[model samples]
Target: MKIIKFGGSSLTDAISYHRVKDILLREKEDKVLVLSAMQGITKKLQKAIRTALKDEDEVECIIKEITKKHQIVATQAIRDTEILSDILERIEKKMKRLERLLYGINYTEEVTAKSRDMILSFGERLSVHIMEGIFRAEGIKSRAMEADEIGIITDGEFGNATADLKHTRKNLKKTIGQELDRGVIPVVTGFFGQSKDGYTTLFGFGGSDYTAGIIAYSLDSNVVEVWKDVDGFMSADPKLVSQAHFIDRLSYAEAAELAYFGAKILHPRIVQPLEPKGIPIVIKNAYNPDRTGTVIEKEGYQREDVIKSVAYTRDIGVIKIEGVGVGCKPGVLSFMASTVSEHGINIKSVITAQTSINFIVDMEDLEECYKLLRKKHSSAVEEVVKMEDEALIGIVGEGMSVTRGLAARVFSAIAEEHVNVDMISYGASKVAFYLIVKGKYIERAVKAIHKEFFKV
Candidate 1:
């Protein structure tokens, strides 16, 4: 059996829905289908939540728009009048519930972490019904199952919850196993799961990929197939370097690094659950299924180039703490790190020196980190600097640690572009190294590095 997941881009409109149906019909193995919301629907739902706190009328308008969008897709995708009507009715019921939830937020003038997660979950919840209805219209036995209903329990962390694997595995095997035995395809909702206390909890944005991984791990499937609009992982972003070509395969570590450093094709945490089971992830294009996409496994082929991809992200900032002996002081770094983490700010990388320590974090969290550090250790700290316009560029491949001259080549490429490197972090991970540069030079630096490694 295989676990197949369709991203939002693959299920955008009526034509896209039909394409997904055809893809599933061609699959021969007993499978479970995991789906994300239609393209742009989640964003609209997020907008509705925010609008709920300010303008109730605008929230209602957005709700209507969301309903109309799904209704149109349902009408076009399901040929049987009965299936179409049933799907439409289900959509209406979900919309009414969504409206009520948003109104609750409006009346209270607050959007707590719990309510926000509930608001975000409506996207996947709605899409699964449409997909299940389409499959049924084609005479395929299918059931629309939400993650919670199928017993996907999480740690209850609200915005970014982790699944309780032992409990989830036992529950999924019992619940979904019965459905599989009956030859029924369980079209499950992705992206969010129910907490221990029965609250809706999400796995962070673009977490549907993580959801697919969790389901694959729980069921002990042979492979996890992620169907998206792109062909596969590339040497670089095609928009940045038009010559960026497809990467046929990658190691689990290399793929995880690329995803974390802004690959965007897969979620950063998707590899975690699957790693324990040694499950391979195949990224295939839903629109062009005939093309072989990138495959990520435990051990990948060694490329002569010594670099698989140049991944870059502009959403980074550095917080530097300066003192006489900041690095030498044992509790200084720990104190600062714990303080920032307590407020839910994630520090991506930490570099230190005798006199200073630097913490790389998300750009949105830079100001808060600065204020937190300043307020806690004002007397002991000399200066707290926040560099918000920094971009992180990473060169990822399994052979990087053993290879020689690769760093020279990368630095030479950046030098050729006349881009100054603000800081560098290496040797922590065998598969990847990182470079921080000014945000203005990010494009130039990425293009230069891609040209050097890929010879484009």
Candidate 2:
């Protein structure tokens, strides 16, 4: 069995819908398909929800656009969209409820997390309907399954919610195969998940990827195809370096390293559950489905290059808490480390000196970390201590440790490029290495590394 997921851009319009049809025809085998909202719909829905809270008049305007976009796509994809009247009727009812919610928000003048979720949930809800409509009209047996129907449930944390995978897996296993056995392609709504309380919630960044991974894991499929705009994971950020190369294959650890340092290729959290199954994920281009974009699986797999990808994260800061005389003291080091973790701040990397320890964190949480350290270990530091906000550049690859001078090669390139390095970290694992540099130098740094490696 296979689970295919198409990103927003791949399902945005009639043309993209046809591309999907072609891809599906090629599969011609038992499969489950998942879909994200049409391109721009999610953002537009959120904006409308926000606008509705401030003024009741905008909901109609927003709903009109939503209806038209889907209608156009449906009309073009389906031979006889006359049957769309019933579908449109159902959608209209949902829109009417949305407009009424506008007045509700207007009177309250307060948009809570739950309210925002309830609004964004419309994106997937509507997309799945249009997709299933087009598929059915085209004589393809298909059915739409909303998040709640498949037990894609989460806590009522509102804006960002984590899925209860154990429950979701059981529910999906029972339902997905039955639909396939009945000759219906089960199209799942991506992103929103029902809460334990039945409220809607999201998984924040990379919500769509999370949805696909969850669906794939549940089915234990051979491959979870993530169809996207680009080819796959690139050697560098294309926006920064024009000559970046696409990595054909990478290990789960490689993808995680790149994602953590801001590769923008895959969600970092996608690895935890899916990779354990050894279910190789193929990232393919929706526009050019024939081309093999990239494959992510276990280590020691064959690959084209020693380096999988070079990625960077901007707007990062490093924080350091120095224990001048407590370096060898086991309990003291534990105290300082526990202090930062207790504040719910992630430690990107920790470098310990004879008397000091420096760690990296997201820039947004720098202040909280600063205050947390000051409160818990203020007396430990004898000299000045602080956090530094900087851009982080990472060179990720499998078997990088084998390339003796890989680290020096990167540092030397940065040096020749006149980019000042702020801090660096790497472990014995040697698959990846990260460096901190000024945000302004990102473009030049990425270009320099790309040219040195890819000659682009």
Candidate 3:
């Protein structure tokens, strides 16, 4: 059996639904289908939640728009009147429940983590119903199963939760195993799972890919196929470097590094569960199924070019703490890092010197992080600096640590572009290394590096 997951881009409209149906029909293997919400629906749901705090009328309007969007897709995709009616009714009921939840938030003027997670879950719940209808219309035996119902119990972290795989495995083997044996495809909702306390909790955004990995690990399936709009992972973002080409293969470590640093192809956490099981992940194009997309495995095919990709992101900032004997001060770094994390901000990387410490974080969290550290350690810290316009560039491959003078080539390419490097890091992961540069020079740096290494 195989675990097949479709991203939001693959289920955007009526035509897209038909394409997904045809793809499933062609697969003869016993497979489980995992689905994200239709494109833009999750964003709209988030919008509704924010609007609920201030304006209930705008929240209602957004809910109506969501209702109309799903209704139209169901009408266009399902030919049988009965299936269409059932799906439309289910959509209406779910929307009504969502509306009530939003209004509760409006009345209270506060959004708890639990309520927020429940509100965000409507996207996947609604899409699963429509997809089930689509499959049923074509006489395919399938059931629309919510993640919670089918035993994806999480650790109860409201915003970002990890599945309790041991319990989940037992529950799934009992629930999903029987269905697979009877040849019934379990069309399960991705993204959110139920906590042990029986409340809805989400994995982070773009977490549907993580959901697919968890299911594959539990079942020990043959492979996990992720269908997206793009062909697969590329050597660089084509928009930044026009010469960027497709990467046909990548090791699991290489893929994880790429995703973590800035690659949008897969979620950073996706490789966690799959790696231990040695489950190979195939990234395929939903629109063009005939194309052989990139495959990520334990021992991936090595390229002639040692560096598989140069990935970069501008969504980063640096927080510099400078004081006399700051690095020598006991527990100062630990105190500051613990404070930031306690407030739910993630530090990407930390660089320290004799008298200074630099904390790298998401650009959006820079202000709050600086404020917190300043308030907490005013006497111990002489100055706190927030550099919000920094970009991170990462080079990922299997043999990077063993390769000779590869770092020199990378620096030479960037130096030719006359871009100044702010900070550099290495040896943390043998498969990858990253450097920081000014945001303005990121495109030039990426293009130059891609050209030098790829020689395209």
- Alpha-carbon local distance difference test for all models: 0.91, 0.77, 0.90
Please name the candidate that would achieve the greatest lDDT relative to the true structure: 1
Each prediction's RMSD over C-alphas, in Å, is 1.5, 3.9, 1.4
Report the lDDT of model 3 for residue 410. 90
lDDT of 2 by residue, 231-305 (tens): 999888878776676778788888888888897667776776687688878888887778988888876442344
Error of 3 at 328 (Å): 3.5
The 10-residue segment with the lowest total lDDT in model 3: 298-307
TM-scores, all models, native as reference: 0.96, 0.84, 0.97
Model 3 spans with C-alpha error above 4 angstroms? 301-304
**lDDT score, candidate 2:** 0.77
Clashing pairs in 3: none
- Candidates, ranked, TM-score: 3, 1, 2
- Show where candidate 1 strays beyond 4 Å: none
TM match of model 2 to true structure: 0.84
Candidate 3 Cα deviation (angstroms), residue 293: 0.7
TM-score of 3: 0.97
Which 10 consecutive positions of candidate 1 have the poorest summed lDDT?
A: 373-382
Q: Per-residue error at 205 for model 3, in Å?
A: 0.7
